[model samples]
Target: MDPASSIVTPASVPDPRATETVADLADQLRQLRLAAHRPAPTDNPLTLRQLAVLTGLPHSTLGNAESGRVLPRVEVVYRIAQACGVPDDQLPWWTAARNRVAGRRRRAPHPAPPPPPRERRAEPVPDQPILADDLLLELGGTAVDKAAELLAGRAPESVVAFLQRLHPALVAKLLATMDPVLATGHLSGLSPQHAVACLDATDPGTAARLLTLTPVTAAVAHLTAMNPEAAARALAVMPGTALAARLPHLDVDLVRRTARTMPVEQRTALLTGAPLPPAVTGELLFSLGFDGSLALLRAAGARVAARLLTALPADPAAGLLAELPARDAAAMLKQMPAEQAAARLLGMTDRQAAERLAPLSPRPLGDVLAHLPVPCAARVLAWFADARRRAVLQRMRPERAMPIRWHTETATYRLWLPTLATEAATSGATSAPTLAELATAGPPPPALTPGTGGPAATG
Candidate 1:
């Protein structure tokens, strides 16, 4: 079959009708691809064999997909995305487009279902009519009307209060029912504290995810409004590095402070990610060498300093790098992308620089690994002497055990030894969580398991 004449035949006896359904599904995909303005990759993202191997659908499936014959299952749709080397979310948009198509397959427009009667949630106000106009605009009124809402009102402020207090899903519905652009814009710009209050009432998980879309200021405002415990829990679920990565894009200072008290990965993410004035970056590095600076950063009580090292510049970054005494900086730096770590390599003293640069050895490998994640620096070196940890405790500023334990507990000894250990063995350390093991979802490292290492066993 000439590839140009796109058509498909399933392996079984050709049922023109079934092929037509598959063909229809394929056309839906094609239309969606066009609508999304997708361009074909320079190299075909799918090979005939690979696509068949992954989807278990035939090459004919592609043709059917291009045509209008077959509808892929949800997994098949994901497989199609995988085959094309695109994210899975791209498929759902097509599914939505197809759903719209399905809706259009009406039997006979059975007199458009009568619009549901409006519920009287609040009494109508005189003069200041509370219509959708308050939310939307006068523009062409048509587009705004079509966008988010048709609201405008002089209803008692209590009505706006009620809407504000509604659950997020209900808010989604109310907003959806109103003019889109107007409602969304208004919701987005609402007071941060109020947003946080509303968000707190929502599942923390959902709120954490949404926090990315909302302005950073808004996130801070909402978090400020939330009780500390609730704010902390929401922050706990979000890794620091992940949050920090977005900080550079934010035009807010609060992002830095907010991330200061988060766990390692999350903090690392924020530090490495937030774009900074070189002066700020340098100052941040200077602080990494100072005890009180880090303490103050984490005083907000969410993310702490240890996890945020990845976010710093080379001088400050290296300052923090040298602080990981008990750990192997080389080992952790080995885990990092060399490009990020290499920048720090340029400034330090010979011995200090050697410890950090040792990871870049093995020539070609170092060059290859240089582009890896930045957090691997401190993490790789956690196997060193307790003296080093003490140095960190001191260099970071004679801080007590609680904050140190709060920040750098990734090492096995970090968990059980100094902080959590009994004073009779008083290495003068922090107290550890009493859980027999680390609270992890998967199995812990064998070295950290019972009796694996002496200190680990003791802890």
Candidate 2:
């Protein structure tokens, strides 16, 4: 009889009953590998040594995996499967095989209970482990800055609790000395409401800057938990991009609630403040991530959203619009005054604008056009390249397209154009003639001389 006859191959089905013991499970894995393996024609059948070389795992590790004393780890099973050239589709079977081994080990019966213990005299408990604050206190006379730097590296919750127990002046000093990034990490770990309270306690400008340094998510969370008025004040002084980047993280409902909390004066200021410098605008937009910026823009009423979109460089502006959901994007377009919306569309190259606008549904597109001043809407439509223009027109109902047709032929300029030209034309013209121009062209009766004219006027 062959010695190998008793050995099970990969072809053998796993016997669920046979896997009751850890040792038995390890044997099954070894047998499965031996059965499933195929070696090159010139080579001897696959061996553990070949598998070790192929897998880059130490031969000793493989040896331990096949050892019956303990179960192999998941990585070990994966490595073994790779060594055997298992197909991708069949990898799950190996995972299942490993899980079976793990489950069997878990189900092993617990050892019998030890005999009941006899009563004994109680012993005093060891002194409790030192608190973090106690440890800091032990650093007597250590610079507050140094102590803070050390503590900043520890878990935030622990540091916060320890810091809260210290004098406020000392806490302020410590925070001033700590790295902003490190402080940001620590602050983020606090509950949102608590973080807001802590921030509120700090100097407002410092608090706003510190919040900017925090992860956008954590910063937004604290802001969301804070009063809208307080949040608005903080945002007003922080980097514009910091707030802009965080805008999307606020949900639509949350935005409405926060917006409602602001006094009308604050709301107007927030909506119409001086634009951030171009560099700051770009940075803020980039930080928001495309999805975030788009979401916030969608929620923002049209005029404010258009102002923000217009501030971005053309590429970013086009990219953002391209990614927006058709309905939301169209709604925003519709909300803007016709000229402002048309101007924004004109800012992008015709091809770029058409491609982005193409996906919007007819009704929203028609609604936006219908509300637009006919001439402004016509100009916007004409700006598109012929092919795109034709395609867009096809999407609109004939009635919707009529306004554009009637207005397209009418030439119009911005309302300020004539005022600007008039200013330019009369800029060189003065209320009184210049001495040189008036000398030859003025009233003929004054020809006598400067001396005679002055004497007569004085008399």
Candidate 3:
């Protein structure tokens, strides 16, 4: 194929300032070559390949120069122009393209030279068995505490395996010699059982002091893995006042999980006594089954239960209320702040709200309803029999009664009454319930059982 015939000059002119920039210089050079190579009606123009052959340079050199990817040397430009039969009169254009590219390079910013590479310090892992003290000093490098930090960052299993090869007494002595805070980090990396074993072998005072120094997470992990009797003995000897203060400050979730295996009284003491935020306590309780959480909620006393309830969404709160004895449910509701309880109940189904609120005294129940969205409060009143509805209405203030009645009467006309106060109340009170709360209203989808497509087929 003849490349020269296929080359169509683009209609758009190159930017006038293109030659001022290196990038534009290259582009301008390409356009110049194409312009120079355009054929006259009487003569066949040379293609880039033919010109390359005549100039004793690769075709790519001409193509790259024409495409502006790379600027050609002045001599190469002169040679391409001469091969293409560019007249001597037009030779200065080729020189100008080459000079523009070179000039741009001189004006462009120059990057700073890179810095030389630094020499690295050697870290050699010993192949042969070494004495405990020597290995400790070598790994630690003049600081026993820093050694603990370094070793703690290694894989937990690897650290434990490395320590197991040493004499037990020597391990105890090494741990005892280091700052307790630093030793806590190294001990935390070990399996809880192994950590417990190591601590048990140390001097009782030393072991207790070290345990106190450990973070609650590491201490709980180790203690939980120990046999109950062994754990109790260790706890009995620890400096009780300091350990007790520290335990309360430890991670609440960790303390909650560890408390499960402890004696009932001890577990209760740990969880109830820990300074856990009410929100965390509610989330933890919600993780348990309906029965377990109910039991804990009951035991938490009215004030704490009220605090926890405010953190839960409507459905789970309703589910909890459904499970509790009427007396306990009423007590929890009475203890709850009127505004929060009303907000939560507004999201509940009419029946759930009715059943729970039916037990409450008139004054408290009226206060709760007054705080609820008009639609939800009206819905609850509608759920009651005529006698109960009038009783509740009679007890409510005129301000509360008027809104509830207005919402109930305007229920079907809500869309037409955008300016009505009840419409705003309905829209403002629509809190989206969580998936867990929604799940409580219906059974979960069945889990996929092994060796079955779904439920077993009936014969």
Model 2 steric clash pairs? 10-35, 241-284
Q: What is the TM-score of each candidate against the true structure?
A: 0.32, 0.32, 0.40
Candidate 3: Cα lDDT at 406: 55
Per residue, candidate 2 scores C-alpha lDDT tens digits across 302-359 of 6667777767664566456646764555555655554444445544433334344555
User: Candidate 1's residue-wise lDDT over 156-262, tens digit each?
Assistant: 23234445654555554444444222232335544555555555565555556555434456555566666665565565565444354333443334333444444
Question: Using TM-score as the measure, which candidate wins?
Answer: 3
Where model 2 places Cα greater than 4 Å from the true spot, the runs are 1-130, 139-143, 150-158, 167-172, 191-193, 227-230, 248-459
TM-score attained by model 3 = 0.40
> What's model 1's overall lDDT?
0.41
Q: What's every prediction's RMSD, in angstroms?
A: 20.5, 22.3, 27.0
What residue pairs clash in candidate 3, if any at all?
A: none
Write candidate 3's Cα lDDT for 194-294 as tens digits. Answer: 67777766775567666775545566666665554555455545653444554444355544443443344443443355445544455456546578778
- Give the higher-TM-score candidate: 1 or 3: 3
Winner of 2 and 3 under lDDT = 3
Model 1 lDDT, residue 362, Cα: 40
- Local distance difference test, each candidate: 0.41, 0.54, 0.57
Kindly report which residue stretches of model 3 are placed more than 4 angstroms away from their true locations once superposed: 1-209, 213-265, 271-275, 283-288, 311-315, 385-387, 394-397, 410-459
